[model samples]
Target: MTNRIVDHPVLGKLTNRPPVTFTFDGKTYEGMEGDTIASALLANGIRQLRVHEGTGTPRAIYCNIGHCFECRVTVNDAKIVRACMTPIQNEMVIESGKMQPAPFKASPEEWPRTYAEFEKMNDNHKEGVPHA
Candidate 1:
């Protein structure tokens, strides 16, 4: 994928800064010097950067303008940075968190198991019948 955000709707093509190469989790990626880490990552097809700190759930960019805290990543020695607003710099170390594996409970076959268990003990109604 092209690492240049030339046709983006909001930022459009960045023509001022020169292109620079950097590594994200050992993968080499290229972006303009002025482009934000999140923008460059999206252009490079990297959607999920890390998992939530406590929940271990996958997280990625939610707001490209830094309003949301979804795109937080560790850069250099810094932690909890909004990647959407942080510009790229030479020799910057970006440590992206690993994606969480899909939970087994979310599988299609597991739905029946969960539904059956819910149906057995659900007694909220006066009739003691579980609602589907």
Candidate 2:
């Protein structure tokens, strides 16, 4: 069964658009029109989208909005985009970004102890951001 909400008291019945066929990671799946790629994947019971870069842990959609980029995926064998924000299209090829694992050497003590330190660390780590 699909994990979609077909009806609701507040919203009444859902009139979904026509189903769109697409491929994710070489596997075909059917999603309804006006559905975001992330929502479609979740409806189809796909929880995990990709792996974490540093620890190699699994990652999935978080926050459901475009704010959190945890649901990023490559679209049409080209640009990487936030799945939660991108609409699904027919025959569209979506591939999860398989971030390679990297060694995390820092222990709890070595890690930042405060939010300010964490911000500092992140600011330094991110590239192309103008230093102020």
Candidate 3:
């Protein structure tokens, strides 16, 4: 995937600054200065930031904000951080994996069909469609 935003209608030429190198899941990529980890990763063509710990589902950036912890990643072998809110530093090491606790846990018997649908709507948002 291409590692730069080109021809954006509102944010034309999104990457104009010098490149900074960072590693994600053992792969090196370049990002512009001041780019958030999520933005840089997406710009670098990485779609999924983590997997659901229980179901092993692919998870990408949702809100692009701190409210949703879906973009969490292990940074520099330190604590897990919200990728959408954290700026990428030169030579930063990033590892992709589930970082937050499950939203809720329940046995299959306890989760009814309607509850499953509700959870799906919640994951994709209540708008009846998941964001691409």
Candidate 4:
């Protein structure tokens, strides 16, 4: 659980900023200021941010930059965003899950029961809209 880089050989003690608290999957963790969500999660010992939307395989941060699109996460129920580029903010609520599916119309009975329930749970929260 010790994810902080405490005494690096070259940089010495790395964490220098005040701590900020955020929630991941409903659990709170402390992260240093100036940390990207990905870095903060890693520092807090969290690897899996989500599952593959198509395959259901566990996924973590792949590229620390904004190009790879592998570090997508829902921030503050606002929209899916890249965790590597988004800086950590105190009291932020992050959710990990498959990417939102494409829009489609289906009968209430035709919708998958679990998906419907999940939608219900998220209804109070505004979905994060991806930027164009």
What lDDT is obtained when candidate 2 is compared to the true structure? 0.84
Model 3 residue 84 distance off true place after TM-score fit, in angstroms:
0.5
Evaluate all candidate structures by whole-model CA lDDT and list the values in order. 0.74, 0.84, 0.82, 0.82
- Any residue pairs clashing in model 3, and if so which? none
The CA lDDT at 111 in model 1 is 40
TM-score of 2: 0.72
Between candidates 3 and 4, the one scoring higher on lDDT is: 3
The parts of candidate 3 lying over 4 Å away from their true place are: 1-3, 12-15, 98-132
Best by TM-score: 2
TM-scores of the candidates in the order shown: 0.62, 0.72, 0.68, 0.69
Model 1 regions lying over 4 Å from their true place: 1-3, 8-17, 98-132
Scored by lDDT, the top model is 2
Comparison by lDDT, 2 against 4, better one: 2
lDDT at 69 for candidate 4? 78
Ranking by TM-score: 2, 4, 3, 1
lDDT of 3 by residue, 31-128 (tens): 88998999899887898999977788999899986998988889998755999999999999999996456554656565536877766746754475
